[model samples]
Target: MSTAAEIADHKSSVRERVWTELRKVAVADSRFHFDFGEFIADFEGGEEAVHRLIDHSFYRDAELIFITPDNCLDRLRLRALQDGKVVLMTTYSIKRGFWLLDPAKIAPDHYLYASTLDGMERVGQHLTLAEIQATLPNVDYMVTGTGAINHEGVRFGKGHGFFDSEWGMLYQIGRISVATPCAAVVHDCQVLVEKLTPDVYDTVVDIIFTPTRTIEVHNPHKPTCGIIWDRLDQHMFDTIPPLQELKAMGL
Candidate 1:
């Protein structure tokens, strides 16, 4: 089967599994009655645990990378900056809403912003989520979150595919290099023991950071460039003029 087919199958399978799990959990825990704050707190106390995890991980020198709009991990970017580490984060948009968390205080030079295809320039280099969304540009590394993309009976992402698309863009631009260390911050629940069937455009994280552990994927896979224009329908790609531009830049 083609890589695209494999990816699609994986996503479908994971979605089913995740929905099943979510439903089960919801049925068991009434507190998760669609309350975002309660859900985040009950799952892990959100930022508090995340802060502890960062301290336990000793991120002073590490290039701190995080998934956008994830309030939990995004807070750690601030701690990383306070400790004088390079932090890169993803943002949704500058005009749409306020950042769930912002890292502008640290001011690192290596911000990598993911640009919207519409030419919404990502704001900062070594940019956080909004930083990437506001300022369309290039950078060195990509931070992919665990469960961001899944294939064939596998599940990924809480519900968003921003990480996968961003990684795809970096790969298309030939920005992801051997030295580029891509990492992800995920909760323990997000990790799966089964081997995930990966597909083209699906980027595997080089490092996975959980509250208790920092994992490294020994052999990493890069994403496929040139967005299969017809196959692109994910809500995350809406208004992504930069996506096509990024793809064309690859060829």
Candidate 2:
């Protein structure tokens, strides 16, 4: 069995390898440099992948979705709004908490602009954890962009725990459950054949959608514990307001 340190080291090596490959073929993001801080690169055929996700029954059936603010997911967010699906998205690192984007409230002309991070703040309603618990419906599906993922469903992103924290917080608040399916959208090169181990708090996705195909993991491991408070550091508590809010609320 690999120790935690060994697994982390392996994951790091995998990320370096994948990121290098991604830059070689990634579509340029005008707002960010490809090598920018933990940016999930938009890959070749990425728009096609989003279209594939839109066609999936999980996405088609979902009335509400919790999507991360990864660069690769901008199109998905836009499509969700155009389809009249409610979108719950967090700010960069969840520093500013969550934003709820209701299609009905947005002007049809702004759907394209509303999908971008800057546009979301202008058009989407911001929500606190308490507000989310009191108002929003349970999330029907979850989608995120990943740095690297394997056939077994294990994934990590640019060494940041943002997605894990998002998942943990939502799970704690009863917005999502073990039965709620999650999907990871990535470039084909980001999918690994080598086995990757997951930490206790790491999220395992039920499905992996690449530009070329969708691969489902049989009986994927999903974390039941919401937030592992003890593992969090003072930096996280200081940087992310939602964490502080949750802590103060004794959640």
Candidate 3:
């Protein structure tokens, strides 16, 4: 077995490679740009990536989906909306709120507009974290975009750590269980060959659907108890409404 340091080194090297790949994609494509250290403005091949998700059981069978608001995955959300799937979107990285799109509440023909970031306001209802929890069923699947990932299922977001926090909160509240399937969609180059180590609270994707491939990560390490509060800075509690609420509850 490789040492932790070795695993980390491999990840660091691969991260750099992936970053270069994304940087190139951003430059060559009309749709993308580098956002801070991560590319988030847009990507040229997003529509193609969305089709990979659509081809999977995770997307085809899920009635309720938890999705990130990354523009790269906007079409995934749009497709979900068009199929009449209920989508639960984190409010700008899960700091502010949660938005729910119940197909019954939206007009079918206008799905694309409702899927956009701005349209989410008109198409979905804003709810407090608690309100969202109360009405939600076990999320059938979760779709996210990652800065880097490995075939072993280890992955990292854009350093904000919001996606794991959201998953942790849901597990803490009993909405997402061990069996819940999570998928990450990215460009083909984002899939790294070396194993990436995860923090105790970092949730790994069960499957990775890239524009060019589908990889099943038989992840062996699973963090059952969610959220490592100490991993968060105090500013998180102050600025993130749901974290503030969680802190107040003394949980």
Candidate 4:
């Protein structure tokens, strides 16, 4: 068995290669809007693959869902709004923090726009960590975009760790229990047949949805504990709203 450091190194190597190939496509693709790193959405047919994710049974049964603010997921969010599901979205880069989106709270005709980040800012109510603690309901399902994932449940998401942090916050606040299933929407090529182990505090996905099919991870592993503050720097607390709120709360 490889050591933790070795596993991490291997994971990084895989991400680098995969991202390089995807980035080449992203730069050449005319519709690509990515300015940062190689995002999964930049790949051909990336956002279009969300159609299969919306039709998954997990998504259909979820009443309250938490999803990323990635533009690639806009269609899924629009469908979620039309389905009358409560959607939760985070600010750009998870910096300003979370917002609660209710279709009932929005105009009937604006449901489509509400799914976009600009529309989310226009209408969604920003929730502080304390506010979320006070009034947030149990999340039935969680969804996010993944750059890559394997059958072992390990995932990589632009190497920023926002998705894991979001999951950690929900888990720590008691909004999402251990049983709450988390899914990552990805293109079929992003699913790896090889194994990639999760690093400590990394949130593993329970399901992977592709345009072709759903891949179930039978042994999904989530964070054993809540946020690993030791892994974070003080600068992070100053930047991320949730961390700042946690500090203000004397946590």
Better-scoring candidate (TM-score), 1 or 4: 4
Best by TM-score: 2
lDDT values for all models: 0.45, 0.87, 0.75, 0.77
lDDT of 3 at 165: 79
Best by lDDT: 2
lDDT digits (tens) for residues 42-147 of candidate 3: 4557677778788888888999999987767778887887788899887665665778888788888767877877788777888766776678787899888888
* TM-scores for every candidate against the unseen true structure: 0.58, 0.96, 0.87, 0.88
Of the two candidates 3 and 4, the one with more favorable TM-score, higher being better, is 4
Per-residue lDDT tens digits of candidate 1, residues 60-126? 3344343344434445544554454444444442223212222454234422221221211344343
| Minimal lDDT window, size 10, model 3 | 27-36
Output the lDDT of residue 216, model 3: 90
> So what's the TM-score on candidate 2?
0.96
Cand. 3 TM to true fold:
0.87
Question: Cα deviation of 169 in candidate 4 (Å)?
Answer: 0.9
Task: Give residue 30's lDDT in candidate 3 (0 to 100).
Answer: 35
Clash count in backbone of candidate 2: 0
Tens-digit per-residue lDDT, 1-251, candidate 4: 88867866776788776666555544342334553343446345655567667777888889999988765677888889888999998976778789988998998789887888778888888888888888878899998877778877788777777788888788877888778988887766677888676777788888887766778888688785767788875666668989767656754
Q: How badly does each model clash, as a count of residue pairs?
A: 32, 0, 0, 0
Error of 2 at 51 (Å): 1.4
